[model samples]
Target: MSNIEIVDSNISTNSEKSCVFDSSINIDEISYNDFFSNYLIANKPCIIQSNATKNWPCKKDWIQNGAPNFTLLKQLFGDCTVPVADCNKRFYNSQDKDEMTINDYLNYWMDFRAQNYPTDSPLLYLKDWHCKKEHPKMSIYQVPKYFASDWLNEYYSGRTNLNDDYMFVYIGPKGSWTPFHADVFSSYSWSANIHGRKRWLIFPPGEENHLRDSFGKLNYDVLEDERIKNDNKSVKFYDIIQETGEIIFVPSGWHHQVWNLEDTISINHNWVNGCNINNMWLALKNELLSVMREIEDCKEMEDWSSHCQLMLKASHGMNYAQFYDFLSFIAEKRINSLVYKTPNLSFDTWIFGKNHNLFDLRQIKIILENFVEDAKDKSIYNLICKNDEVEMLLNKIELVFQSCK
Candidate 1:
């Protein structure tokens, strides 16, 4: 068992400390290439200031009088069971999580708020709700152009095994928060505050070592961790107060914690593109290694490798086989699009232009090639290569790239 800490959610004393971070580069608009070069590839966080999500119906329907419309939420999603996090309770290094219907949660929230959200019973925070699929008719928000090439959501959307996606809706009372952690798969993420304000504590990669305990778990309260501020004082951090309607870009591998400065609702997405696909691949490999180590004592057991692979899939949401499946699916589509010269049917062609565009077929082929080369460096690639479909797809990817050349 790990050390569990019961924290008071409403501590605002940390605001008195001096915190310095580069004011997020505010831009009215950005191009795909510029974003890729300066931020995605560079792995730098920024904030894009624009009225990009003003048209989202939730902005008006889900909020009233500068706070979440609790009555509306109960009316709309009363029976919908949601994953709620207890913000004031820590289970190891993360918040204790539970599930309750929107109605039940709102009922509890109403009672809690009326009693001023007591330190016990935990602050119920509805995190990662799949609002888009549940209410497809509701015109929410559009994904920004800079972070548009999202393979995770694009591939998963076609499969029913996981209808949920990187797109998420987070609703919580004031003081509800997420603990410090990096985005899964080392992927980049962006959060657009739909309403209310959030205080974000973002630390660039490499500095997380200062905060993680010997067990490799990050501290729950990043802002108030004295071990980080007084002991290993070299770690610098960004304290950002994200306002409603503003989108905050969290670069690949940046560890962050978020607190609802007021009753808040936000839409967030975790994404991977050619710019950070390598990082995603690396993260997957690390996950596999960790899975292997966990079950190493059973290595001599029958089908141990297969068991490890199974655990990898269950733990990380995908295994090497699924990775190959995703790669093959995208590569085959792109190859067919190139072979048929169908620009309209080709996402790469539309976004990157026919040739030498922002993300052309040829550029995609190169990324696939790089990924394949990197995958080959992994020991598990041998098992992946043993699959007939994987071999065929690799050959097809090569043929398509050569033909384009």
Candidate 2:
């Protein structure tokens, strides 16, 4: 990449003090009311001065042997450039193999690096290369459970149920150099750097113009490049270099760009609690709005009625599942037409084109309002609708037009 570096002393310190965490400083040590009120619920980012896997026996006893452990992890991780490995026939060997340690191995694979590992090596390119099955000894999702049992017991005392919408991402070196953008997913996230270091540049949401009408989606890469050139103007940015045993909480919709500074390992959990339910609902509403636009677009086409009739005939006597698949295909065509277009009309102008008059804003509003209300009340909507409301609405509108014909 991009050699843009923005450092924030608010999050970074050169203290040589080693932060140690054990059962004594578990989640119970911090009061839930205080923690949630002051930190977690507010979407404020904090460094939990504790080890994520302090209670795990494997992590405590794991040795940094250069052969079997390193060899096995390499086999599991595959080849990647940031980690710098060469293929020795079917197997791959790292140039830094001799310097492998527990910290180094953990750092190398934990950051987003594994995904960016050079694909040339057969050992790395296999689909199942990095796949790890859940086992009694090594349960992937159970890491949170272990933390709850050991550290978070006190803090989780009042919170009866924890939402499972969170994601656990382990990013390593060689991982994709993420562009500056906010997450479209409707949840806040907690990122813990278990090993190595990462540099982060963050900006508050809504501060930057998305420029989507020109580029379809937000052009984060271009935004990042521009931000770097104008850095002297004191634009909002934070550079975080988290070492082993630290956690950083990132709120939803905050624009952030992260790069692995070295062989790094970090786990991120994206979750939503009761307080953030409104944000999630708004995200859903945006999806519905997009769908309504597509439905309107499909209705404006000259052959719209005929196309819908043909599709309906194709789905005649088919099961609900088959009908849905066919409908999805129709929806995809409308969405694709919107996304990939000539330079003649911009996305916003194209969306408001004269051809979109057939469905009318009133009808589009009704469909969108109905979908959002239904989603909030019954929590039952088509999967395609949940994933992308615009496509589903377009397909459903086509079906309605076909019925009228």
TM-scores for all predictions: 0.84, 0.48
Each candidate's lDDT (Cα)? 0.71, 0.40
- Give per-residue lDDT, candidate 2, residue 257: 69
* lDDT (Cα) of model 2: 0.40
Residue range with the least summed lDDT across 10 consecutive positions in model 1: 1-10
Q: Taking the tens digit of each residue's C-alpha lDDT, what string does model 2 give over 1-405?
A: 111111210221122322221112255466433444444335444555555545533333221431123444454443332222212231211111122333444454443244556545322111111112212234332233212211111112222353122233343443334555565345566665555566666655554453343645554443335555566444554555555555665665666766656544455554543334345446655654444454555876775434443443343322223223433333333333334432212111222122222222223334445544554453334432447655556565556445434
Which of the numbered candidates is closest to the native, going by highest lDDT? 1
Per-residue alpha-carbon lDDT of candidate 1 for residues 1-405, written as tens digits (9 for 90 to 100): 111111321212112222234345544555555565567657777777647667767887888887678888888889998899888778877878999898988888788788886777678899988877788676766666666666677666655576667778898888898988889878889998888889887887788888776888767777677755464457877778887888888988889988888778899888876567667777887898999899889988987777888999998988877876776665555565568764322122233233322133434455456556655775455666675555566577667666766
**Candidate 1 TM-score versus the reference:** 0.84
| Backbone clash count, each prediction separately | 0, 19
